[model samples]
Target chain A: MTMAADNRPANAVPRTANRDPYTPQTLLEVAVEVFNERGYDGTSMEHLSRAAGISKSSIYHHVRSKEELLRRAVSHALDGLFAVLDEPAARHGRAVDRLEHVTRRTTLTLIERLPYVTLLLRVRGNTGTERWALERRREFDHRVAELLRQAVSEGDLRADVDVRLATRLLFGMINSIAEWYRPGRGDAASAQEITEAVVTTAFGGLRLRQ
Target chain B: MTMAADNRPANAVPRTANRDPYTPQTLLEVAVEVFNERGYDGTSMEHLSRAAGISKSSIYHHVRSKEELLRRAVSHALDGLFAVLDEPAARHGRAVDRLEHVTRRTTLTLIERLPYVTLLLRVRGNTGTERWALERRREFDHRVAELLRQAVSEGDLRADVDVRLATRLLFGMINSIAEWYRPGRGDAASAQEITEAVVTTAFGGLRLRQ
Candidate 1:
């Protein structure tokens, strides 16, 4: 099982495994859960220490502060997302085709890393780290927008739709995945299925007829 | 020119024109701003008073307390949304057509009442009012999902797509309008243009060929 699955609580903090001592990675996994529950600003060192069964001072030994935890969590999400852009399918295909590949990978990554990504989506640009993450997120959006613009330029997408509007529309569909998706629900649709539906709805409107 | 323009700040308390001094409507406008700023749970009556430029005792003359203010604000947003369901376009058209109308109106309402709607979107099931609002929101979703199901049954929508997925995909496109859509930039698309773009993208692929 993945660390995320083994490490997370269904709705709150996970159990501390007696087998492993506290490390930055283990502490982050606990901190992310507390952050999600009480919210980033609402959570404090006391909460993290209690959840991790570590001294508050010990947590500081591994990370600078709660903000560092947030930065690390969001970075995990960003890295997962940016990595999708470098995949062969995202790079080597027709603009529309490449976009579809990115869209599918994005949905899958979001589902697979549900907690990290959820925290990423909830950011409101309050702190320096948060503002940085938001900037990077906009950069990611612009990169994907460039692909949509290229698709429109190549006549592979509908000419009537504005590319900027189309980009937001595509991302709107992708980002809302965080609002409703829950992992490990017996009846929940698999990430592939969710990605397929999103890609179909977004690209279905843009793809040129043969 | 419109009250909406006066009420646009994400956290600025709205002041009423009446010198009668305080009404529930005016008090709610101020309370919602505080709630949006400090968050529903994070806010206190003192915070509301500071924002409203009134004393806690004076606020009680208008609102019972902070939670009452949250109830009123969410109730206002719920009423606006439910009102859309009763419109002629939403009620009298073909299922697919009606869904498009709902999608458009929902997007417009969300943008027009951006702060209130943003607050509504961010609520977790923390209190009685929040839970009630979430249940109502789910009912609204299920109602729209039923329309998509009906359209598929009538062969007016693509049978390949899942109805629940389609409903979420459509609203994902709509709810996202709140995230980055600024009101008055010279380059910003008008509300009509946005509604049109959202409706077109939402239904373009789903509509059966004539």
Candidate 2:
């Protein structure tokens, strides 16, 4: 073991000399995977390095800390979700229709950004970043709640159920997709089919209409 | 800052001589609170001891291990859920009616056993006990799926949506109550209101009935 002393100059073998360099983008993909698999708290820098096939020093080059990786991932997911609210379909319609449009689009956004949203849904507000994510999540929910209230006032949605409770159940059904949905699994529901299932069950009622 | 070594007999200041002894039931409540606060993996026997105001050795006198506490908690929740299926209303009614009854009751069960079910919902299958809990959960889902299929065949529920997917969504909506519901808290929905909201929005749909 003592015979392995290096004689080569420091410049002879740079860290990135042997293969493609690890970019922040690529490193982030690995970090999110590890985080989702082993929860945000359970994951450590060493886990990320082992998962990414890089050294601790190499990982530091890409991100400042694990929380930075978390912020970047959730921000991507939140960006996708918040954009759905701005869609023309979501914006210019009867309140019920607009609510449905938002629901449909939010479902698609969640499926498209499954890993990120899965991570987002599991945040417990233990850190400043997680608390910020939770606040943003509440803002999104509040916007949706307003849409629901408008729909109820317009006599479109059922007026009997509490609008806030209805909103939670609606998104609850959508968010549960993260717990079980596997995009490429055998016999998986097509995106169109899943979207239809959500909209139809949520708005049309499970009982057949006359 | 070193403490003086004890010179008295061990029985002079026995650990539990002056305290309300830690029973398994109260110990489990403390353990679950800690587990939910710091995830199961994050929690330790030391954490449990600190939360219960007892020593780890005292805890071991009541339960075998942390996993035993997890098993006990989830089993309590699961027993409440599975018992719903055996009720006369659940077992003897029309399939759709039975499904609705089960849904309404399960929602109530979750709210009643909020802490227990909350811990059950967060199990990640990291240990044998968790995996067992997951299997029991899936069995419960399968039973409900069968009820949904029966309802679909009976022409009570709509036949268009996939039966299993509908079952998942229905229960998903029910299960999400664990995330935000705070029993006895100010502005918390009473069990009656919560149950009505779930049943109405789930079966009657959120859209106004003409």
Candidate 3:
């Protein structure tokens, strides 16, 4: 797995005849796959190296440690989800509409970043990265719950259910997308289709009208 | 953690002054807790021993192996969930009402068997027991999906959404209760209340009604 000894610039095209170079981004993708397969706690550097088709030292050259890989993967997922909140629809719409927008976008994001989001969801607060992910997830949930509360107060949603419980059930429905959704598999639903289903089902229950 | 050497049968009450006797049921509970704290693959017999406050030999006395404990835990959870389908409300009603009964009962069973259900949710198909659990879970899901199909055919539910997707989202919302739910933690909702919320949120969205 050693690169050629020639002192070509690191950014230049790879000198190796057959081996693909490992960028941090590519390595992170490999690491997330391994982490999901073996679990974050069960994966080892050797396991990652085998899966990536790279050596341990080569992996270290890209990321310092496995935990760093976890932090990066979940960070990407969290970033995608948190970014949804700032979209024009999420920001400017009526509370119910904004909540629907967030819900749809969040489902799309989870599908777009399936492995990273799956890792984020499976975290059990076992490490700093997992705990941090949990906290950020809570923050995101709270923000959505606030949207639900506002929607209810605006007489747009049902007032009978607890906002916190409603928010959890809504996202719970969305997040479960990661568990069964397989991208590019046989007859998989398009991201748009899933988003529509999630939005309709979630808001259909919460909205006061048919 | 050795039991006193007595000629009495293993089932006899313990002779130890202060130590509580560990029944297989009690031991299985401890194993499930440790398995959840540590990912099932990451947990060892030693870990179970530590958590159970028993010796390795004593743990073996109750169960042949860690996998046996896992089998027991998941079986208990699966039995509870599958039993919901057998209830009269689930078996004989309007398709929509039967679906609602299954949804509400599944939520209550999840809360009632939180740890076992949580473990069931997090299994990653790493071992035989895990694989078996996954297959059983799929069968259960397929059964519910059929109910959704029936409901849609009967015009009790909206036909716009895919029946399979609707069933998945419904149970996804129900199963996620295992992730964040902490029974008796603080002002926790009762099983009946959560059942009401799940039924309302899920059917509220699915039913063809105002």
Give the winner by TM-score: 2
Identify the runs in model 1 with alpha carbons over 4 angstroms from their true place. Answer: A1-20, A205-210, B1-22, B205-210
Question: What digit string (tens of lDDT, one per residue) describes model 1 on residues B90-120?
Answer: 9987887887778888888987887678778
Accuracy of chain B in candidate 2 (TM-score): 0.90
lDDT per residue for candidate 1 within A1-210, as digits (tens), equals 125454434224434433235667767877887888888889989998888776777777888888999999999999999999999999997887887788889888887777788889878788999999999999999999898888777667776667788788888888898888776678677788888888778766421233
lDDT of each residue in B71-137, candidate 3, tens digit only? 9999999999999999999999788889877887888888888888889998889899999999999
lDDT of each: 0.78, 0.84, 0.81
Pairs clashing within candidate 3: none
Question: How should the candidates be ordered by lDDT, best one leading?
Answer: 2, 3, 1
lDDT comparing candidate 1 with the true structure: 0.78
Clashing pairs in 2: none
Model 2 Cα shift for residue A193 (angstroms): 1.5
Pairs of residues clashing in candidate 1: none
Candidate 2 deviant stretches above 4 angstroms: A1-20, B1-20
Task: Give residue B39's lDDT in candidate 1 (0 to 100).
Answer: 83
User: What range of 10 consecutive residues in model 1 chain A has the weakest lDDT sum?
Assistant: A10-19
Q: What DockQ score does model 2 reach against the true complex?
A: 0.67
- Could you estimate the TM-score for every candidate? 0.89, 0.90, 0.87
RMSD of each: 4.2, 8.5, 6.2
